[model samples]
Target: MTQQNPLPQEDQQVTLISVRDGNISVTSARALVVKAHKIALKIDTALSEPPAWTDEQSLTMIYTHGERVMRLRGVLREQVDTDRITVEPVGEVKEGDRRDYRRADVDARVYARSAGTQSPTEARAAQVALQLAPTSNAFIPQVVNISGSGLGFTAHEVFSAGELIDLRLVLDQPAAALVNVIGQVVRAVRGEGDALNSYAVRFAELSEADQDIIVYTVFSNHFAAEGLSDALDDFDE
Candidate 1:
């Protein structure tokens, strides 16, 4: 039987209204800090082949630090409507799986709430690390995959969706300045036996200089490396 991909009917907008320590509430638009240690969010395209649509549900999320499981909750609010989505005790928060679901391409327009707006032209690929100002939890992630506007990485700490956060990124090497940024934990995923947790993050705001640096350092290098690697592979063949 063919598996069905999970898709949202409309654009979802989540808000972190409050937080007591590590836990948070979605009452206003704010930056989100990632806390999940093992994330495995995948885009299931059961709604459309090659999925012409963009919205996705972080259908699965698991939070584990070392061997212990952490239960969590989140809210998904629609941008086009007043409907709100809440996921509680989010199923089973566990490891990732290789064949549990199809990895559909996600090209959604995810935005983070901030006092200011940063253009998508400022979007770039960079190794970002985050933590809540009040807490000492650090969200160190491994960027397993990325796109022009989105990023996929892994972490194991449990963070409520829509939580606010301060981000520091390791910009492209050589001049790898630790640039500050504000973003949200748009989506998260985890499975029964998967190795690493996966997350999809969207940037909310950044400085112009930092944005240029990111574009040149992160986005340019990624593609340039891919092109070079492909050429070398072709040469080898």
Candidate 2:
């Protein structure tokens, strides 16, 4: 089957998985080029780091854009460079089901408290302290965007990958509410200007009520900004 959706944009984040002899390995990488039937990925390290890749090894890649998840299966091809690898799709690109809550771009304040150093004991203690005194030593970061599942924001402090965090999303206008949730850091990249780091986080366990509020806020803002409220209403009819 031919591709039904547009090609993924360059530099989109992707998770690559390789399985060999019952052992599986996964890595978070970026797409260098997305084509009709192939994709080039920017490899950050030698093949040995994530275990060696043999010729024609079957690989699976999952990527998300906005709210859509795409799953592509292909066989590894020639290595373009020490930092690049190519793969040719085995079949048509499979688009996952649409997310119930779409991501929305919003300028808001995010109050975050890092779980602190890698020491598990220290991290747990810090987490408990924060829970006891929520706003005592929080970092007020600027939220770049958010969705029901996760969010991205710029913070002055660096947050290590896999760190746990407590977040309070503060929306001030149109709809005002303080939504508190816990999340884990997925990735962190340096941001422009002095000392700013961009962090992507995936929400951890959340109560049903909190989940509903986040979904409602994101959808509301997205529709208002896109002027899609009327279109949505027409569709509902």
Candidate 1 per-residue lDDT, tens place, 163-207, comes to 433445543232334445555668767734755555666555555
Give TM per candidate: 0.34, 0.48
CA RMSD for every model? 20.3, 17.9
Q: 157-200, model 2: which lDDT tens digit per residue?
A: 67788987766666542345566666788998987767678889
Rate residue 132 of model 2 by lDDT: 34
**Candidate 2: lDDT of 187?**
96
Task: Please state the error at residue 125 of candidate 1 in Å.
Answer: 23
Deviating ranges (above 4 Å) for candidate 2: 1-99, 116-143, 192-195, 229-234
Candidate 2 global TM-score: 0.48
